[model samples]
Target: MRDPRMSAIGKGLRRRGRLMVQAVSPPRRVAPERRALNAVPAQRDPRQEAPGATPAPRAPRLVDSPVFVLSSVRSGSTLLRVLLNSHSRIRAPHEMHLRTVHVRFSRDFTADAMKELRLDRQELEHVLWDRILDLELRHSGKDVIVDKTPANTLIFRRLERCWPNARYLILLRHPGAVVTSLTDRRDNPDHAAICDEVLEYAEKLEEARQHLDHAHVITYEDLTADPERVTRGLCEYLGVPWESGMLDYGSHDHGRFRPKLGDWSSTIKSGRIQAARGADASLELPPRLLELAKAWGYPVD
Candidate 1:
C-alpha cells in the first residue's frame, strides 16, 4: 500500500490546483435576457405589498376627515367643488389628482430601510397624501377640505384605505349627457371607448354608493333644480350650516378656472349655477348605461 501521508498530500494538491484553474478562467458571460432583467428594477405599487406581512399601524393624520367627491368625467364635480369652496369653512380646490402620485424604491435595500421605520411603500404614500390635505386646509383657512377629482372614482378603495375616517360625496349625472359631453369636448372621440370609460366610472360609483354607509349621494339634476334644498342637505351631512352665499359662487374668488386642473369650459367658467342640459330622451343607451342609470334612480324612458 502507498504511504498514507503521501496519499493525503496528493489529495490536498489536487484540490488547490482545481481552485487555481477556476480563478484564472474567464468569468462566464451572463445571458442577454438575464442582463436585461437586472437592468430594470421591479415596479412597486402602493396597492400591493409583500404577501403575509402585517400592515403597519395607522398613524394619526393632520386632516383626518377630508372629503372626496367621486364622479365620472364631465359629471359636474367642478360645479359641486366651486359651490362647496364658496362656503366659509370649506375649501374645495381644483383636482389634486392625489391618486396619480406615487413612490418608488430605487434601491433593493430601500424598502427594507423603510420597513425598519414601521412603514411600507403604501404607508409612506398615505403620509404624503395626508400632508397634502392638511397643507391645503391650513392654507385655505378652512376647517374642512374637499378634493373633487372626478378620477377619484377609479381608486376609491385606496382612498378609503388611506383615510378610514374620510367622507365621500358621490356625484352622478345622466350617462347620455356624460357621453355627449365627452364626444363634443374631445377631438376625434372614440364612441366605444367613451362608453367604456363611463361604464367603468359608473360601476365604481355604484359600488361605492352601495358599500359606503356614510357616503352622501347627489345628482346633477337635483343640484341645479333646487340648489338651496340640496346644499342645505349637504351642509347638514357635512356638519355645517347653510350659507346663502354659496349659491352666488360667481361673486367669490374661486381661483382660476382652467383645463386639466378641473372644468374650464365656457359654461363652468361662467361661474353660474346653470341648469344642467337635459339629456336627450331619444338617445338610445347601451344596456350597461341603461342599467346603471335605472339603478341610480334616473328615468330610462
Candidate 2:
C-alpha cells in the first residue's frame, strides 16, 4: 500500500513516467499539539495571491549567445568542452551548474518586492548565471563562453528561456555505451536505475534537438573518430576561425579535471582524444534504449 504521506510527492512524477529519483528522509515525529499547527497551510507568495497579475518584466541578459552542450553523463562532453576551451575565442569552463544555484523567497512579501523591480526568482537566478558567465569569459580573455554541464540536458528548456539567443550543441552517444559507462563508474550500480537515467537524458536530448532553432547535433563516436573535421564545423557554427590548436587540446590548460566537475579518468588525463568504445553487444538493452540507439543512427542488432 502507498504511504499516505508520499501521496503529494508522488504527484510530482511526470505523466510520461519519467522521474529523477532522490533519497527521501523518513518523516519526523511531531507532538500531538504541534501536528495541528503544522496542518495549517503556509502563507502563499504575493504573486500567487494576486488575481490577474500580469507577467513581470525581466532584466536584460548579460551573455546573449552563450553556447550550451546538452548531453548525457559520460557522453564525452568534457572532451568537447576542452577542445572548445582550446580555441582562442571560446572559454568552456568547468560546470557552472546554474540550475543548482537558486534564489529563495523567504518572506511572504519577497515575491512582491522582486516584482516591483522587474525581477522574480527565476529571472534573478538568470541574471546571476549571466554574471558568472561574463566573469568567466573575462578571466579567460575569450569572446565566447560555453557551458557543457551534463546535467544541463535536463534543464535545456529553462536554459533556453533564460537566454533566448543561446546556441546549443546536442551531443549524443549510443544508449548502450551510456548505460555501460555509467554502470562501470558508479559505486553500487543499479542497472535498472542507470537505464532510467539514460532514457531521461535521451528523451531530453531528442526534445532539444527537435525544439531548438540553433541546435547542432554531434555524436561522441564521430567526435573521437575525426575531431578536426567536427571541431572545424563547430568553430564555423560558433562564428570563430578554426585553430589547429583546438585539435591538440592536450597542449592547453582546460582548468582542473576532477570528480563532480568532469571526467577525471586516465583516458582524459592521457591528453589525447581516444577512440570511443562501441556498444557492449552482450548486454541486453531496454526497449526504449534500443529505440533511441536506432533513432540516433546506431545499429542495435
Candidate 3:
C-alpha cells in the first residue's frame, strides 16, 4: 500500500533531519589558535629598545613651582583668588581643592575627623597641574601658579608631601561668621556637615602650624579691609615686589575670573567686604577653636 501522503511525510522528515545535521556541523576548521592569540604576552616596543628604553621624560612640568592659597568654603577665598590674580605676575585660579585631592591618595585619613571629603587624587592632581601649566603659558610663564582651593587649608601637610617645595598661603576667617554664612542655606542637606567642616579647618590649621614653615597666614578680614598691608606682607613673603594694582584690586578686569562659589561672582566683583566690620570684634568661639585661633595669633576679641 503505497500511500501518497505517507511518502510525502517521510521525505519531509528526512529533509528536515539532513538540514539539522548540516546546521549542527562545524563551519570550516580554523588553524590552531596562533600562540600569540592564545595568551596576551608582553611585547617590547622596537623603537623603545632601539635607543632609550623610555621616551625622553616629558619636558619637566612647566614649573615645579606651585603656590597654594588654603582656606575654608565661604571664607572669602574667591575674593582672595581674584585679588591675587590681579597681579600681572600671578595666576590664581579659583578653588582647585588640592587637599581634597591629596587625602584620597592617603590611607591614614580618619573618616570621623575634621578632614573634609576627598576627591579623585590622581585625576584631580593631573588636571590641576595641566591647568597650572596652561595658565603659565598664557602669562608668558613669568608669574607663579596659585591655586586657591579652600579644602587645601586642612590638607597643607599632605600637599607638601606630594609637592615638597610647594608654597602655601593660609587664609582664615572668623569661625562664628563662617558658620553663619553656611547656615543661610535653607535647602542644603549637608549644611550642618559644612559647619563641622569649618570647625575641622580651624583644627587642622593648628596642626599645620606645628609642621609648616613656609606658610604665611592671611586673615580674610585683614585682606579685605587693609589689603595693602596684608598684600604687601604677602609680596614680601614671596619675595615679589608690591604692585600698586594689587591695592586697587576692585578696578582689575576679573571678567574671566571663575568663582569657586559657583555664580556668586557678583559677590566678589564689588571687592567690598562686610567682614571688616567684625574683624576687630572679639566674638566668643568654642573654647577649643578659640585656643587654636589665638595660637595662630588671631585677635582674641
Task: Give lDDT tens digits, candidate 3, residues 1-301.
Answer: 8999999999999999999888764644332311211222233233323653322212234456578776766677777777777787877754554333321322334322312333233334544665655665475444677777666665576566546667888888777666666555334425445445567877776666666776888888888788888888988877788897875667876455543432264566665544442432333456666666677666565
- Model 1 pairs whose backbones collide: none
For 51-149, candidate 1 gives per-residue lDDT tens digits of 787887777888889999999888899999989999999999989978666678877888778878888888888898999999998899899999998
lDDT of 1 at 278: 66
Clashes of 3: 2
Q: Candidate 2: which pairs clash? A: none
By lDDT rank, best first, the candidates go 1, 2, 3
Tens-place lDDT digits, model 2, residues 1-301:
9897688677655533553333434556753422422343333455644667664565787788999999988899999999999999999998877777766688878887888787776687789999999999888888999999888888898888888899999999999999889877777777787788789889988888878867889999999999999998999899999999998889999878887788889998888999998766777778988988898898868
Q: Can you tell me which runs of candidate 3 are displaced by over 4 Å? A: 1-60, 98-131, 134-141, 185-194, 256-265, 273-285, 299-301
The regions of model 1 sitting more than 4 angstroms off are 1-48
Scored by lDDT, the top model is: 1
- The TM-scores, one per candidate, come to 0.83, 0.83, 0.62
- By TM-score, how accurate is candidate 3? 0.62
lDDT of 1 at 198: 83
Instruction: Judge candidate 2 against the unseen true structure and give its global Cα lDDT, from 0 to 1.
Output: 0.83
Candidate 3, position 211, lDDT: 66
